[model samples]
Structure formats: C-alpha cells, structure tokens
Target: MTDRASIIAVLSALAIAAGGAALGTAGQVPQPAGDAPIIIAQATGAQATGPSAANTFNRLMKRPGSEPNIQPSKDGIHDPANPGTALLQWPSEAFAGFPRTNDGNRVDWVKTLAAGLIRPWTELEDPEAEPFLMDLTIVRQVKGSMPNVVYPHLEHTQWLDCTNCHDEIFVPEKGANQISMAGILLGQKCGICHGRVAFPISDCRRCHSQPKTAEELRQLSEKSSWAKQ
Candidate 1:
C-alpha cells in the first residue's frame, strides 16, 4: 500500500483498540489539557510548535459559506462541458433551510436529525430495517479547566450502528482506552468522523457541553477512583 494509505490503516487499528475502552466499563480515561484556541496536543507525545502554530490552528477552524456555489461550468470540480453537471443542484440550495452552526458549512446536524426532517435508511437493500437508537449518555471529565465532554449515544446511535464504533473506532468497555485531542486531530478515535465527515472540533461547546463543578474539580485533584481511571 502507499505510505498515506498505510498510515490510515494503522491509525484505524489503534482507534479501534483504544477508543472502545471508554464506554461503560468501570475504568476511567485521563483527560487532556484544554485551551481557548484549537488545542492540537497529541497523545502520541508529539508537540505542536512554531510561531505559525496559532495562526495555523485558527485557519483550521473553517467558517461556513467560505465557498459559494456558482453555475456548474464555473465551479472547479465539474466539467462545464457536461450538460448534466449544470443540472445538479448547488450544495447551498440543497442544504437550504437546514439548521445552522458557527462553522463548517454552518449546518446543525444534531438539530436537523431531531427535527425529523431527514429519515436516512439503515440498509440500502433492506428498506424495512430501522436504526437502533440508544438513549445512553457518557460523560468524560476534562483534564484542565474546560467543561467536561458529554457523549450522547442517542445522538450518534440514531444514525450509526453499534458496530460502527464499538469494536473499531472505540472499544465498548469503559476506561480501557485513552483519548487525546492530538489523536483526534490525526483522525483517530472521534477524529475518524469529526473534523472530516461530522462536525469539526473547532466548535468547542459542541462536545465540551458540561461545565466542571467545584466538587468534581476537587475529586479530580485528589486522584479519585474515576480520576485514576
């Protein structure tokens, strides 16, 4: 395989091994440091440096409406010569009226799903098949002062199957895996979908929804069982 493809395969394997360990098992994973700017620290021990690091992080936070849709002819991807391409609908028009976000095309997918505007089929061949939606939520405490992460299984499971994450991207057991911001930016763990197909981590509030309570902070510092987990 090519170098790029090989790298992807390895990351995919690691994600499967490490990610699944945080679901429901009694073990707990350590949290990474947080920051106002897009934190790019890696669990792999690589450090981000250089003066441009700040600018680079800011630039990576993509804003919606950066690329406007024009006639297919003028657009870069399509062949203007092809009449069929012109007939295709622009993404702006296609996604019109959908919920919006602060970044990345500005589409609020979770709200869109909750609104019942879209009903995606689970299986192409079996139209009768339905998605198995779970209502569980997993909370991961952050390492520093940032808000804790609230992972709602209902939101994700509504669209994906248990297998989509369980054995591959994340392990099903709790505290078995260690997740880091750096691993995610590299497309490991949650990065497999986030920042790529799903919402980008630039929207810090999206995942870091729960704020830390004073008691929680004390427990974390004291190295409580969950903290050591």
Candidate 2:
C-alpha cells in the first residue's frame, strides 16, 4: 500500500544513513570545500608531509595546535548574506599578542586572564558585574592508569558564573551526571564549550592533572580523618 513517493523518501534516508556509517567506520570526515585545504602544522612549524586531511576528530584528539586555513566560505557558518557576518574579524588578528598554548586556538586563556590582557564581562547585560571567583578544586578519580582530573573553580569562575553550567550542561550535584569521552567528542557536557568557544580537548594531561596513587590517597584520607576528630 506504500506510495512511490514514500518508497523514494525511505530509500533516500537509508542511503544517507549508510553513507554516514561508512564515514564513521573509516574514521574520516569530509573537509569543507575550498581553494586552500586546512593543514595540521608540525611542531617545528613545517607542513606535515602527506595528503592527510585536516580537521579530523582523531587527528585533533591526538595532537593539538593545528593552524587551520579559515575562510568565510568554509568557516562552517551557513549564513552568507548577513551583513554583520562580513564584519567579523579573523581569528589570527583577534587573538594577536595573547598568551600562547600548544592546543586550541594556540591561546593560553588562563594565562591571558592572569595577565589582564582581556577582562571578559561576567554578564552581558551588566558590564559592571564582577565575577564570583572561587578557589575550590574538585579531584575526580578515573578508572585504570589514567591520572585523576582536577577541576579548578577559580579559573572558570573568573570567566563564567556558576549558573552557566548548573542544571543545564551539567547537574549541580556530583555523581548525578554521567560523562564519557565519546559524549564529549560529540559536543555534549564539557564538550559544549571545550570544543567550540573554550579550549578544545587536545592534551589529556591538561585535564588529568591530579595523581591519585593509592599511598597518596590513603595518606590524605588519614589526615582528613585526624583533622575531623
């Protein structure tokens, strides 16, 4: 009883899904079409010798500091006719003289904040509103040999309010949210900002900073118990 139109639509959907699966299986994503192809720069600033595609998730995940050849046409923004879009400044000029990093736009955001080069407003409406900075550190123990992650509130609070993350991207309560690397890569949880506006998850050591050895954890636990008594 299916009409010809319905059959055609279903086949088209299946074809699209199949194409996506093939791309995922091959671990390759289509690069934006442009005259200049984006390339990942070597540590020595030399061009990587190969036909390897730039802006691949695996490549970015493995290495940081890939200088992309950004262009209006290939910038991923769909809007072209908007007048304000043309006024937007390029990344190189905008981020000039800022502290440098090995990963994510090659700008050290934390150090930049410390150096007072740029003072981001805590709120958009009220420019005078001050940031609510906190010095609390949360150490999350990871499974297996990976080092534990240390989430510093002070650095983040300086740029954002607590409400920015609470009850939306992340649940305020600990152990309530389930986070995974896959989810993060897919632009979920910390990935919301980490990959887009904030620093991309390039180096694992950047987040996995705390060392949670059994002896160290035991000693710390004992000290905490004694202090509580």
Candidate 3:
C-alpha cells in the first residue's frame, strides 16, 4: 500500500508539470518582474522597443546641427553654427598676418633669422669652430631654361654632421655623381633630405639663384666635358 501511494504521487506531479508546459506554449505563462518581452517586428525585421546602444551614443556625441562642427584646438572657441562644437584653424591660416616672400610664399623665419644671427666662418679662431664649409652650384640642366641650384654647405653642416650625407648619400668628390630633377623626385640624392625634413623643393628660386644665359650653359657644358676627361 505504501509503494502504491508513492506511484500515485509521482503521476499527479507529472500531470501538473505537463499542464504548466502547455500553458507556457499557449502564451499564458506570466513573466517575472523587470523582464522585458522581446517582440521582433515582421515588417522592419528589428526589435520594436527602446533606444539601441548605437542611437544612444550618436545622441550623446553629435550636436544639434545638420553639419558637424570641428574645433581647431582645445583652447579655441566653439563654432557659431553649432554652439557645443569646437573647430581649429590651420597653421598657415592662423599666422597669415606674418611676413611672406615677394612671390607670396611663406618665409621660413627660423632659417632666415638663423642665417643672420649665426657667426661667420672667418670670425671663428678654431678650424673646427665652424663646420667644414663650401657652397656647391649644381648646373647639370638638360635645357638652359632654369637657373643653377646653389647648395649652401655651411647652413646644412651647422645642423648635421659630415657623416650624415658625405660618402653614403653623395660622393665627396665633385662630378662623381649625376643629380637630376627626375632622380630627386624619385627620392634620390637631394630628394633624401629635401621634401622630407628640409625645406620643400617647391621654392625653385631658393636653390636656383643664378639663372644662366644660353652662353653660360654652353660654357658650363664645355667645362663639364673637360672635367670628365
């Protein structure tokens, strides 16, 4: 009689569990507190519920304007179009009031001031006091259109040591290597320094100071041939 009672109790519990499962399948199950119902919309294929994380982030980050306002710097004031948005000005635009060259190019004030303030090679008593200085004029032009490039060795040596360029980049002997605009553009010879760390190659007149006449070009060619021999 005890075994019979145990079997009956197990059957009754199973029947109750089966009824609960049926109720759950038929949408009759009650949700626990703080639980949200997940309802996927068939039309949009999206959850028809509260704000998404991405939408919340956009609202917090973007200002109340159609266009984005970008400030130049931290200390700069917010743009008028978007009150909260800060914008920054370019270095050229910021210092537009400063002096420029005759051709309306920006003058390198640091280099210009250094040129004037620095001591002359003659004034220095020690041979090593000033860097081993010489000026090289590059006249290897295919056409006699542009001027010769005047390379100031003293200015470069002041900032850099001899080993920085000397047998590695350029041969120490004159006329040992041939430098051309094509090679320079391809990052050879002068291109290694210029347009990288040094002043850009855009300022043609800076190097090409002496514009040679047709006669000068002929004389230069003759001199070059003699040197080769």
Which candidate tops TM-score? 1
lDDT per residue, candidate 2, 56-113, as tens digits? 3343332222234244543666366777777777777777899887767778888988
Give the per-residue Cα lDDT of candidate 3 at 225.
57
Instruction: Rank all candidate structures by their lDDT, best first, as comma-separated numbers.
Output: 1, 2, 3
With candidate 2 superimposed using the best TM-score fit, by how many Å does residue 24's alpha carbon deviate from the native?
41
What digit string (tens of lDDT, one per residue) describes model 3 on residues 1-229?
A: 3345457668966876897677763223343233343323213233548655334333223222212122234223444566444344554454355444532224454355365543445334664464555555444444454786667676676666778888999898867878887888778998887656566676677778777878977777777756578
Candidate 1 has which clashing residue pairs, if any? Answer: 16-168, 19-170, 19-171, 20-170, 20-171, 25-174, 27-175, 28-229, 101-106
Full candidate order by TM-score, most accurate first = 1, 2, 3
State model 3's lDDT: 0.56
Q: Which portions of model 2 show Cα errors greater than 4 Å?
A: 1-66, 69-87, 214-229
Stretches of candidate 1 off by over 4 Å are 1-65, 68-75, 126-128, 218-229
lDDT (CA) per prediction:
0.73, 0.71, 0.56
Q: What range of 10 consecutive residues in model 3 has the weakest lDDT sum?
A: 62-71
Q: Point out the higher-scoring one by lDDT: 2 or 3.
A: 2
Model 1 — TM-score against the truth? 0.63
TM-score of 3: 0.42
lDDT of 1 by residue, 6-39 (tens): 5776797577567756543333435433333434
RMSD, candidate 1, Å: 18.9
